[model samples]
Target: MSTSTGGGVPASRFLFLGTRAGHSIADAEYEAICHYAGLPTSRMDRVRLEEGPMPQIDLDRYAGVITGGSPFNSSDPITEKSVVQQRVEADMSKILDEIVARDMPFLGACYGVGTLGTHQGAVVDRTFGEPPGTGHIELTDAGRADPLCVGLPDKFDAFLGHKEAVRELPSHAVLLATSGPCPVQMFRVKKNLYATQFHPELDSTGLIERLQEYRHAGYFHPDELDRLTREALASEVVHPQQILKNFVEVYA
Candidate 1:
């Protein structure tokens, strides 16, 4: 985690808000985010929401904010959620209120789509859920012109696996990218707040680690690990990381 000195947090540093529970998963997620964003560990501060209550954040301390995927489903019944999940959601929601209102620079991956989408009045449910695998992403006319999609191909494969999705684009959002199963692959709210249905931070090794961590978490059958690992390693997924890089370049 990055820290502040007696003066204040440096403006060039970025903060990654993580929601995964296990220490290894959380650490790996932060590492992958920094790796893909071309940010050194020293330049990226990590807040692991699963560990405890989130502290009041001073947004001015960092260049931007990024939230990682979580096992907690936004669409889950309130009664079905665990205590930690409820607290984490509340903490995320509180921060989002300020982030969205101020048009803060934020990029949410996978589960972030749900939180940000829900905050913006978009419906997020299990309707367009996709299995764990690589999916085709097509950049929209707007996507092609968007700075975040600058170096990306018109169409490419990205790793995605979620139990819920943004069923429709929020009224105030710009549809940046689309995919076959899940149409709202990426969208921008206001000028700086962004969300993605895919995991841009994931490489083959990272994906393998996540798959193992969540194997019993219901994403896929435990028996499929062998095949998933093979396919994951064989797949060429080099474009999505550009999103992370673009975000960091534009914001930092």
Candidate 2:
């Protein structure tokens, strides 16, 4: 597919698929990502997959797709999942089918790892869930050579907290980066489709805000909110955002 908009108009902006139900939190996440991407708020389209059915978006109208983290875990049994989670998962499956077939540009963060891994037949469970905090991630040989990892350092800190992760990468997937707790921190499918266990779009500020909102959501002890905020604030996470900026530059 052509990545440009014909007739001298600027290319269509990317779509950010957010699953967070809280309007404030969802908007904050989307705005933070767009800020780092150097794209105006107007250049990005935000969709809340949790609110209702996935809208019928024309792929040709977007340069790529970005899916954010969520409270839902793909490892949960069908009977345990909420109706919204199930519906969102089904919609994501159809979207990924088209993305993979066309090799369209995509970036799935946090919960996105579970969604894409499950769809690709990978083993996704809570076997390697990391706590809510900053962790160091190292790029593998494959990751070093990947276009998205071009300007990134071999090792860097990133915000992460997940209840489930990919236990085994899919047959067609290439492992990109790895963390101490999560073996499959990042991976790629056919180059364009990428999934990461960390939140590439988040900074210390963004993560701190999330910590406050999700403290009671079971990511961590409610009393540890203050300590968690301090730890996240102390961490220097500058390189991870490069991945987001690079994706837009390369594909948009």
Q: In model 2, where do residues sit more than 4 Å from their true spots?
A: 1-12
Question: What is candidate 1's CA lDDT for residue 181?
Answer: 89
Cα error, candidate 1, residue 141 (Å): 0.8
What is the C-alpha lDDT profile of model 2 across 176-218, one tens digit per residue? 9998789999999987999999988899999998998898888
Displacement of residue 163 (Cα, Å) in model 1 is: 0.4
Every candidate's lDDT: 0.90, 0.88
Q: Which stretches of candidate 1 lie over 4 Å from their true place?
A: 1-6
lDDT tens digits, residue span 1-252, model 1: 223333556788988899998888888989899998999999998888889998766777888999989999998899999999999989899889988888989999998998999888899999999888899999999999998898999999999889999997767799999987899999999999999999999988988998898898888889999999999999999999999999999988
Clashes of each: 0, 0
TM-score of each: 0.96, 0.95
RMSD of 2: 2.6
